[model samples]
Target: MLSAVPRFAKIAAVVVLAAAASLATFDIADARRAGSSGFGSRGMRTFDTPAITRTAPTQAAPIDRTMTPRPQQQPAAQPPLGAQQRPGFFGGFGGSMIGGLIAGGLLGMMLGHGFGGGFGFLGLLLQIGLIMLAISFAMRFFANRQRTQYAGPGASYNNSAMNNANASPRPSFSIPSIGGGTAASQKARQANDEIGLQQADLDRFEHLLTEIQSAYGAEDYATLRRLTTPEAMSYLAEEFGENATHGVRNSVSDVRLLQGDIAEAWREGDSEYATLAMRYSSIDAVVDRATGKLVDGDDRNPSETTELWTFVRKPGSDWVLSAIQGTGTH
Candidate 1:
């Protein structure tokens, strides 16, 4: 009885350790998925946070001028008019089934090969471990392949060579100083102009938000590459890489710009800032690209779910997303 107690204690400890290890692996895998190159074929993008800044003169006129000519420069790349349909959901389920079968077969082989003195208890555990490892690798690989397919072909072209070509020259504008009027008129005009500019900014921001949401839905990471901050870009790239190994893909179903209010807009020294609150949805999923297995759901996907994204605008610069905070959804 005394010897048995010691052995039982040892076994219990091992079981506990194994459970803890599995949980840890699950967390690591989660993080990896966030930074993984989805489906093993995509790259990651970095994400940054909003920072404080000082004020600068608004440059509205040049933006209008540049934007007009810009649209005419290139023909819009339209998807086949009928290409908007969602990919078949069963694709993911099928891929998952296949992965499971492969993993099970591997386990059977391990057990059959005298893994545990006549394929007994110890052998069964060994086989389970082997199968889990195989499944992990398969998921990772399939995820990468699928991600690439969804992201489309040669996305790098959009980020580097093509984007630079499309980028228009910087727009410039001058703000009239609020001085020299019977001080009262000066103040009133300044206030009026600020209100008008703020409204325009809101409109512009909303438009960008809509475009980004559309890009995500279409699995167009290339658009995100240009619009998102460097930090966001890096984070996304890492996420794409890790997920690609597992055949995972993120699909945002909708993004509603619930609100867009100015937080701040100014220049500290040479840098400028424009902070705003953007409430939206980011319906997403982790799925097997080839088989379309739905591995998970994004908290921002459902109609009831919401997310917060912040944008930063430098003095004489374009607005770029700097942060994305989960609004009680993480």
Candidate 2:
């Protein structure tokens, strides 16, 4: 009876060891990174919070320049006219006037020499009269054109002096100054308002850091899209797709913020952006999507990491994640 009892005990021990090994194997298989770093593709901006940073990782192109202001284009200059159109008896008269004056002078000289020894001959007198008439007509045409341009259409020379007297005054504007005593006081008040806004930004940054990780763990891509910029969302979607292809999933939980500090904040056009360096601890694990078995990262161990995140918001708008940068795990 004692020998039989010992054999049974040995069989039971072997069964117990086999069961433990099976459980260990179950815990070892897990999905790959489901979407770490919020899947943001914004390049290694690190401390770069500028709006001009690349929208995706490894991209070497310029950023969208829509936020920058540009000068308005001025109208093109009109080409000068080489010739003028003439109308009625005086049409194209500038050349005619010059020609007539020369012809009349020659006729007058010839007539004067033959009829009155170049003194007071009737023919010469007639030619001199014609020349004077042509000169007066040319002067009249020039004076009329000048009046038409300045005084506008349908204006009459009879009231030319009256129109000049009634011209409207030049425009005047009063500009507000920012250097005087009262202006300086206003500027100081504005600075105080900016301080309050920055505090709100800090609060938002902390909230997003936790919320974004939770969404990544859950593989809630829709939530990520709403919280992050289009570029960041696309990058995250790609990570999710890669995980799906490999039949793996990442799990993150117990996200606790350890420390955070603002690197910089500035307004561009109607939007404001902030860069933050944050240290945090979280339980991050990869598992098999189909079996929910842990693949990597100790489920019992929480990790500490440092990262830089940038958020942007417009007036009366909610903050959205624009970028993420990672530092090595601690």
TM-score of each: 0.40, 0.44
> Where does model 1 exceed 4 Å of error?
1-197, 264-266, 281-283, 293-295, 298-302
Error of 2 at 79 (Å): 44
Tens digit of lDDT per residue, candidate 1, span 1-330? 334333423443355347447845886777644521211100111122222111111111111101112223367577797786554332667567755554454344343432233555566456556655655676567767767777644587445534433544222111221112243233223331322234345555666777776775556778977777666656656666777777776666665555333433444455444444344545667777788767787534455333334455556777766555433322
Query: Against the true structure, candidate 1 has what lDDT?
Result: 0.47
Best lDDT among the predictions, by candidate number: 2
lDDT of 2 by residue, 1-330 (tens): 334333323443344345435545543453223223333422333323222111111112222222223345588655568654344334456657655655544443333332123444444445445544655566567767766665743466435534433543111111122112343333323331232333344456667988999999999988998898887777777778998899998899888777554444566678776655567789998899999899888677899876667677778989898876654345
Error of 2 at 241 (Å): 0.6
Write down the lDDT of every candidate, Cα atoms only.
Answer: 0.47, 0.55
What's the residue-level lDDT of 46 in candidate 2? Answer: 30
Ten residues in sequence with the least summed lDDT for candidate 2:
170-179
